[model samples]
Target: MYALENEGGIKKVKKLDQFLQDNLNDLRDRGLYNEIDPVEGPNGPVIKISGKELINLSSNNYLGLATNDHLKEIAKHAIDQYGVGAGAVRTINGTMDLHVKLEEKLAEFKGTEAAIAYQSGFNCNMAAISGVMDKNDAILSDELNHASIIDGIRLSKAKVIRYNHSDMDDLRAKAKEAAESGLYNKVMVITDGVFSMDGDLAELPEIVEIAKEFNLITYVDDAHGSGVMGKGAGTVKHFGLSKEIDFQIGTLSKAIGVVGGYVAGSKDLIDWLKVRSRPFLFSTALPPGDTAAITAAVQMIMDSTELHDQLWENGRYLKEGLLKLGFDIGKSETPITPCIIGEEKLTQQFSKRLREEGVYAKSIVFPTVPQGTGRVRNMPMATHTKEMLDQALAVYEKVGKELSIIN
Candidate 1:
């Protein structure tokens, strides 16, 4: 039994408390517990935590627009005009002009006829997948799809068939099997345009061909790919399969350096989602400030490739430096580099040592990746200078040598 203290006295623990305590204790014991460090100021290439400044490589601010003066000014201007909140759910008068404009801009950005915005990328998946799919439908998901995709599929009550990650043959076989089964009414194929952990691009062209052969609906969550790939248009655009795909999901929080998610597709699809997607129907709309800022950020990406090119340049520099230092960066095709450490405890220790040496790359362990494939995922931003990258690489080299992770 455990005891807890309140304002007046101590009380015996409830069953819930015991369960929580047991699980948390187990996680700590096994080195699976994640300790979150709060940044003291703005989230940028360099950040301060616990009064120490560190070169930040864990943020998803790909193009570094999160702290861009222009975006900040836009957000501030929006806040001044719209005040603090949207006042109610979207269905109940919260769909302001800013929201509409953002959706329109998103559709234009994604090369779709229309789009619908959600509070977050995760929520977008939940609303979108469940809105269109049901128990009668079957979802063919990649084995390495994001957690949000998994939850969304679960919420839809669909029969999930996970194909091996990036294995086109496996995908084709499953697609054939599901299409011929006659057990489901709709079969949707879902994949992350860029797998977050491994930083690999999805085999969308092959997936599209398989989908065409099977008449399956294709859904690509390009959260990480948008603002970083396809010359800042995303993975679908990168492959020039924008018109061929069905649902294109993206997050404003990542490359756009704003907050929210959207599903860009045909006008009919957006109309259907607007009417049927529960999050769109029930949840409050994105704040006016964020909506306006997101639109501006999208426009910024569409306007120039300067930031995108710089980001790629920085990514290549970092990856090449790490490779030269003999670090095992797993099969990454994007800027997301994972320095694989193999064990959870050691991976966490490696991250801690990197922090102490003035870099802030976080360790991702089991449940996020696989048990033995733990890594410190490094996300290089457009704002990171050559100097910052060099500093981070030096720290990585020092830590790698000390931990005996690299020769």
Candidate 2:
């Protein structure tokens, strides 16, 4: 506990500012402090940061729909009809017709019996995980699961058994131990359908098989997989195991090009979340424009795979270009490319050099990934033209040679 002397003779805990300054200084000294760069305009294939235009590669806008003309129009129309905000929390007066419709479309899109939406993807994890699992339960979570999932499990107060990343054997061993331990009331296995940092797909088929063997509850957060896999449905649909998984989690902000998160699952599960999830019950509903745009985005994805295909094409082009330049592009099953640079400060320097040379891929370091595996993560969007990718590649080559990261 930190305390400071008050103006009078009283002792007070007024060292918060000192604490923050010390921690911030430590991060800066260690090269772990992240500096936020504000984009000057719309976040698209090309972005203006500090008045300089660069090929944007740090965004999660996989489909490039965030700045789509049609979606923008729909969002404007929604604002006209319903104003900017959802007046109250869902349990109060906030459950608008658009909310109902969006949930319906989400259920249809995810191939689930029902769905519930939350304010954000992070909140969905916080709400859903704690809503279902309690202290008596045990969760066998993938070691590389998203930070949101980790925090959600912590909130649940469940016994968290971390399985090695994408290791089915480890998962099975842990699942069996937890399920037959006779201490837990229930056992659950949760994983990200697509690990965001490394861009690897989870082995859902094996996980589903193991879950069935032990009657484990299965949860897949497909925030990155949805709209990019399974003809734009999700990873669950990709593996043809929609009916087998217990929770199908996704976000509207990423490929969907809007804002919000949802859990699509059995009707009972959704119903339970609606009432039990703290965020859904306590926070205001998603605003009207975002909800409408999200619905439109899902419809566009279901209507065609044009954007999805283009995204993959750009991803492959960028990946090939980086690999050809002798950069250590990791084995990414998706478009999320990581140009591996070994040290944290050097990785940050590499990213800084890339930006200076007109690319905007961000460096991801320790705490986001393990130490010594720092890299610049590139997210190629659907709208990135061939010329844009070539330019980015040229910049990468120059920076790589300058840093002696490649031959």
Task: Give the candidate number with the greatest lDDT.
Answer: 1
User: What's each prediction's clash count?
Assistant: 0, 0
Which lDDT tens digits does candidate 2 get at residues 208-252?
999999999999999999999898998899999999999999999
Over the stretch 50-156, how does candidate 1's per-residue lDDT look in tens digits?
99999999999999999999988898999999977898888889989998898889889999999999999999999999999999999999999999999999999
For all predicted structures, in order, the TM-scores are 0.97, 0.97
- Per-candidate alpha-carbon RMSD to the true structure: 2.5, 2.2
lDDT of the candidates, in the order given: 0.94, 0.94
Which ten residues in a row are the worst by lDDT in model 2? 9-18
Poorest 10 consecutive residues by lDDT, candidate 1: 1-10
Show the colliding residue pairs in model 2: none
What RMSD value applies to candidate 2? 2.2
- In model 1, the Cα lDDT at residue 108 comes to 91
TM-score for predicted model 2 compared with the true structure: 0.97
